[model samples]
Target: MRQGSNFLWFLRAAVGAAILLGAVLLTACGSVEDVDLTPACPTGVGRGIWDPGSLEGKDAGPEVRKLLESPRFGATPQAVRDLERGIVDQRLIAALRTLTQEHRICVRAFKEGHYFLPGVEDGPRIPEGYGKAGGLPNTHYYGRAADVWWVDGKPVEGNATDQDVMEIGEILAGIPSGRRPDQIIGPPRWARDLGYGNQRGWILAPDQLELHRDHIHIGYVNGEATNETR
Candidate 1:
């Protein structure tokens, strides 16, 4: 009888162990169904018409020019050059303006030597298989993506946990669904330990997380545009 009881106990213990392991695995591999994928704020505040001349502060009018020239919403020289060449999405500029003006968050868009190039340079190297969507080149190539390494005058490297950095990520993530950035990867804390797009939240895989430790990468759908100019 004792032998039978021991066998039963062993079986129960094995089952319990298996259950525990499964739970651990489930938690480690977070389920998309379980998490709230809905955008935190879907107001579409930053949506703006695509004006290639906006980068030069011309076609979009004086307000956009003022915003682009503002110290609070500055960019690196290379980024400025890219902007002058009309290489960034208009929505991104609007988002930057919103971040700076509405939230009082100073943002330096794109690290120097990095703006719209594909291969990689300073800051975080674009992870392999990233940047491309639907058999097309990466969003950066199409000017729909940017990497901001400075916020509130602080470098993103050591300030990943800073309030400004976290807020920036949160705001970017909260952009309206559909027009929202499909890729919003930043420091671990603000990104909810994952990301916020691709039907699974930004950082699709663990491998992509490390690549975004030093900068906030924001990429939108390639062809999206708005009719309203700033």
Candidate 2:
């Protein structure tokens, strides 16, 4: 009878262990599923939280934290460092990565005063203050935009020639429009060629020859407007 009791106790312990193991496995699987796990941008780099309101250094939520850690945005050493301190949209980072990698070029984070809320007296206004049609600042205020220059084969933040920067813009212009009415703004031809006559909104073409001569601007645009400049 004692032998029989020992066997029963062993069986009970074994069953308990199996149940605990199953619970652990189930918890892990559930965790993987419950997380958004969506590619940060469209390129399968990182997980992006769509909240544009969370600026860098301001919002460190789990979703945004995951995006900041993505390797796709870590093109140049400077870019990787910038990702730590600044907050730009995941799409913008992904697009910039594509441009630099495709052409073997290098670009860094926008100069300190360029992004929305540069935290300086003379910094440029966010797009919301641009005073133009469809200029509600969805892109700049949300940190979904960048002004990148071509530093051919140099480290991020390296100086770029005018021709090299223009070339970078041309390639960036060809990227398809995004879920929002995104644009690549630089030389007129680049914008006109890619943005002509599509259901999507027009990519802006600079009228002045000297506009954006130093860099290319690409990112989201204001909401749809009938009078939006193409």
Candidate 3:
């Protein structure tokens, strides 16, 4: 009788262990199913957040943190497969990762004073009061988009080139042939007057050009350029 009881206990213990293992596997699978992963990225020599898979920086939240740590977003998933195939452009993929992180109407990398082009001059330094779009005192607007050049820990000679910066203007122009939209803030008339429509057309409110002469101020609902949803 004692021998029989020992056999039964052993069977129960084995079954319990199996159940625990099954629970762990199920939990892991569930977690994997709940993350958004990007694909394998080309290793750019530059230090930008081009690799969305490594998005576990101080800026990420729980959802982003979980996604970065999971297999679906990490490897062996459609997003990863797309990246490996070059089905998605690395720059565009990086941009999308940035755009989706917040409900930001516009995403820009702004510097100080002027719109961040490759070069600058020593005029009266723009004070703290200066901002993009209509960023005026006592009357600031949200989603009036703009970008400034920013490079951390690198000494700038005040004569940077397009190659050094991510010229989004050039990227937007190439979108049309690829079956994407012409652009949100299209090429300037200055560019078109020079006649280069062999590429896709650009998109920006013609009337507001004067107001945005200094910055590429993108507004969401000014009855002009309100395409913040994309």
Candidate 4:
């Protein structure tokens, strides 16, 4: 009986040690994935780390208010006020800044514009396929989207050309794919790879929607309208 008790004690000690070692090894192997954008706002009001399952409110935090106020967004003060009515993602704000910087030379050289220019009558409206599964694919209601008004050297609405469309498409497509399904909505391949949306693609076609031709729609592709509204 003494020998059996000693053996049991030793086995228990071995198991405890093994568990501790496994935990230490797992902690040592912890990964640090790169995030493309650091959210300017806190984890609330539609401005948290990108999550497709989550919906956010339209309330802008201090950081978001600062972004809206910046001239770099290319929106007049009034236009910014209008956009603030809908909820926008923190990632989209970061993406817009990145997009503007990426196209600065083109904008300067060819007079391209972004967001809302001074005289533009309209701003971003909800895309036609806001709730469609394979369409815009979980964007719009939460303000994770925008419409760019200029491409190359002309206005997107009535003046953009096929070449302009291709150029902007490549740029928009090149934005790094999101870590989750709801983080992005674009090419069907991209959506499929993330394990969401149908295979038909998310970019609206000219025939499918007329106004889309003038301006390219950009979004962080997070969450459905029904889920978001509720």
Predicted candidate 3 versus true structure: per-residue lDDT over 39-96, tens digit per residue: 2221231122335555433443444343333322222233332333333333333333
Candidate 3, poorest ten consecutive residues by summed lDDT: 137-146
**Highest TM-score scorer:** 1
* Backbone clash count, each prediction separately: 6, 2, 7, 2
TM-score per model over all chains: 0.57, 0.43, 0.25, 0.41
Per the 3 Å backbone cut-off, how many clashing residue pairs does candidate 4 have?
A: 2
Better of 2 and 4 by lDDT: 2
Alpha-carbon local distance difference test for all models:
0.57, 0.46, 0.33, 0.41
lDDT per residue, candidate 1, 1-230, as tens digits? Answer: 99999999999999999999988977986764553322211223111223345454335444446555554555544565556655567777766676765333323344345533366442333444544322344556566677776666566777777776777766765666555566666766556643444552365545455666677777664467522221
| Winning model by lDDT | 1
Expressed as tens digits, the lDDT of each residue in 112-187 for candidate 2 is: 3444334533232444333242234445444555655444433222223344544565455455655333544544
Candidate 2 residue 24 C-alpha distance from true site, Å:
46
Model 3 stretches astray by more than 4 angstroms: 1-54, 57-171, 176-181, 186-189, 193-201, 216-230
Query: lDDT: which is higher, 1 or 3?
Result: 1
Show where candidate 4 strays beyond 4 Å.
1-72, 76-78, 82-86, 104-139, 162-166, 179-201, 204-206, 224-230
Q: What's the lDDT for candidate 3?
A: 0.33
Better of 1 and 2 by TM-score: 1
Query: What's the distance in Å from true for residue 77, model 1?
Result: 1.1
Pairs that clash in candidate 4: 156-214, 157-214
Candidate with better lDDT, 1 vs 4:
1
